[model samples]
Target chain A: MSEESDETLLKRLAAGEERAARFLLARYLPRVLALAQRMLGSRSEAEDVAQEVFLRIWKQAARWQPGGARFSTWVHRVTSNLCIDRLRVRKSAPLEDAALIADPAPGAESRVAEAEQSARVAAALQSLPERQRLALILVHYQELGNRETAEIMDCTVEAVEALLTRARKGLKDLLLKDAAFDAPVKAVSGERQ
Target chain B: MSAAGLDEQRLSELLAAYGADAARWPEEEAGALAGHPDLKSKIAKERALDEMLNAFKVEAPDAALSARILAARPGREMRHGTGVWRALMSALWPEGPVWVPMGTCAAALLFGLYIGASGALTAMSSDPQTETALLSLAMADSVLEENWDE
Candidate 1:
């Protein structure tokens, strides 16, 4: 049930209660998928990572000790580590091979503008260094505390803060540049109209 | 530090790291930064960036992906109360109660003991000279050609 804690659900899962696995997947799959998508910038790869993460959960559920990190934190840690490993392998591949953000279905003008903005933001995020990007994702997007983010990154809180500081500054600069680039294109389009 | 005590530099650092939302800041420090006079300009700048970042929305995983993930879960055999030992037991004797195999083992042990005891008693009841000859023959390194013929 939604009222049950994650640890309890894990215990139930270990007991072979199918509902517990479903509950956990519903609660965490979205977040895990999103984190991987942001980290890898590809939906298919993110899905692969999500499947792997859940498989590990199923394998570890029986052995999971409740006294250490919270279940949610451990899930994030697993997902983050898996993404990092894939990114390392991807480093050797051509940058252009990374999938572009899929465009949202067409709708109102405002929706279109929002999607464009979202794409640009995603691109800017992808441009950041791995650690900085992870810090931002864990803190800003994932809504984890600096301390928890530090644990996931295997670094101190101070280091997380440092990474966040630089991440924000760098993101701001990238968005500003993107805006500047968009200005000329928009101006030309406006003139044609 | 108190709200009034929070300096501009520290506030700026917190804003940059945690964004314009005071709620996202460290619990101990959030109260100090909230409603502070110096936060007006800096908060506005960070809020703009936050708004921009918020534009990047990630949709929930589709049903297909969720199904795929759920399908990959460890099988029922691996669950508690049905581990490797249980699996092995099931493989060795797939049907009937556990007591069946156990009873079979017990029966075999008793049968072997009965045979040994009966054989020993029969040999003891034999003529004394013949019993001695049998004992000597059993201890010999090799049976002679005459014994084999017998």
Candidate 2:
């Protein structure tokens, strides 16, 4: 049923129900894809990572234990680990790695500026160390709690907070040095909410 | 208010690390910082950072990506059948150490071997035809000996 929880859906999935797989895919695909994209900075690579994560989910569903972690958390853990592994392998060929660039050719002039700004943000994110970037993505974008992010990162909650602080500072430094947010960043400290 | 309350330094650090949104901040810190007059301007600065960070939106993957992931699955056909025997087995020992059935089979084999050996021994001692054949052979040998003596 549509109202069933992820654990119930997993039980059906383990029993080979096709609809359960569809349900899981529909619910988690966007989140996983977004995480993968943010982690890897490549659309094609993120897609591969998402596919691998789902494949692992299918294999592990039958043996999934409910008490340890929620299904969504487990899925994010898988996605994060796979993305990190891919990033590790890409370290040797760092020059080959490039973030996906968006083209806003057909849009209005303001839209083009927005697209360029988005690209700069993506580049700044990609420039961060893998762990720092991941910490930012988990807390800021994924909106997971500190404890949950710690569990995924295999660290304590304090460590996660420290990582986030450093990430925020690092992103600020990167954006300031570049000309991307120069106009508004100068006024950020004085700006009122 | 100073001992358990959020001081300016800690509140500033929390704002820098977590965001302008008090809800996203750690519960203990959020509670301590709530309605604290010193934190208003600090939170306003943090809000600018949060807005900048939130501006980077990730586009959803194409439909073809979903199709690819779906196609890579091992599929429903590869799963075990849901027959009564299978269901019962799954219920009993869904995943296992696998030694239970093996131990039972070994014990049954040993019992069968023991029964077979004891039955063979009993049959060898109890058969009338075999006993009669032995007695007849002994009598014929003694009769031959008496004829030789004569």
Candidate 3:
């Protein structure tokens, strides 16, 4: 209903109301799916992870405490953790984790040049160590507070800051080398958004 | 700006709120974000960098996927249904310490009734001599039954 606040729905959900659960699932599943797709790089895997995240929320809704944390934040943390676990298991192929380190820079050129630059940056991100990838995603992309990012990363705020700094610096060093931006960049978008 | 223009805490706060909605942030930290000169560039940097990070859009589960995940084997569905009921009950009305004593007393009362009923039925169905002896024993009580030495 138009008058239902998230907390009210969450309370109903905690009380095992199926209608509230359906509402919660409808409201948040897209975001969870988007996050899983971005982090895990596979639609099938993302779908699986999204289902698990929903079922988990449904099963454990009673454990939630109101006014404790943002529901989105909690769900985002769970989705991120699940994606990381899936990524860790894909060790067989010659994947493009660090392929952006080899991409060209954007010289005095067109929007295509900017796209190329972005492509390199994206490549550099996937290449980083998993912890650095997560820290960067939380702070730089998701814009989570340092403390929240640290909590999601299961580390200290100081560690998050350090990881951000390293991730950015690493990206810069890789993206800026050999300033001649004449190399033909790939037309594909990054693996994750 | 001086070299000591921004503290580390303020810098982190500025970076945290730069690209995101300021309203979602704590007021003190949001104030720091607004006050800091570098917030815009840091957010721009983050935005640009985020683009380079793959923007993978995950697909939602289709009916087939949902069907597979929700499928149960044998009597598993009934078990899960019961579990859901238990979860709902626990959430609605948490159990306290009273259940233990209530259960124990109920069990004891049930056991006492069982023993008394069994003894009576045995006495009723027994041989005449045995029944008379038992009846006399019951009437005379502990003195005859225990031999009274102690």
Score each candidate by Cα lDDT. 0.79, 0.74, 0.58
Q: Quick one: best DockQ, which candidate?
A: 1
Order of candidate numbers by TM-score, starting with the best: 1, 2, 3
Clashing pairs in 3: A97-A127, A122-B52, A122-B53, A192-B54, A192-B55, A192-B56, A193-B54, A193-B55, A193-B56
Q: What overall lDDT, based on C-alpha atoms, would model 2 receive against the true structure?
A: 0.74
TM-score against native, each model: 0.72, 0.70, 0.51
Candidate 1 CAPRI category: acceptable
Q: What TM-score would chain A of each candidate receive against the reference chain A?
A: 0.86, 0.85, 0.68
Encode model 1's per-residue lDDT on A1-193: one tens digit a residue.
3789999999988877767888899899999998998888777788899999999999999999988988899999999999999988988987643326533454787688787777778777777788888999998889998888888889998899988888887777767545432212111011100
Interface C-alpha root-mean-square deviation, candidates in order: 5.5, 6.0, 8.5
User: Which lDDT tens digits does candidate 2 get at residues A99-171?
Assistant: 3442213267767666666766777787777888898898888988898999999999988988888777767
**How do the residues A1-193 of candidate 3 rate in per-residue lDDT, one tens digit apiece?**
3257677877876654545655676667666765665455445667889888877776556677778877777888898888887776776655654333233333456655554645555555566666766766665556567778777777886677667666555554455334333323333222331
Best-to-worst order by DockQ is 1, 2, 3
RMSD of each: 17.7, 18.7, 18.6
Off by over 4 Å in 1: A97-99, A102-110, A177-193, B2-4, B77-150
Off by over 4 Å in 2: A96-110, A176-193, B1-4, B77-150
lDDT measured at residue B83 in model 3 versus the true structure, 0 to 100: 68
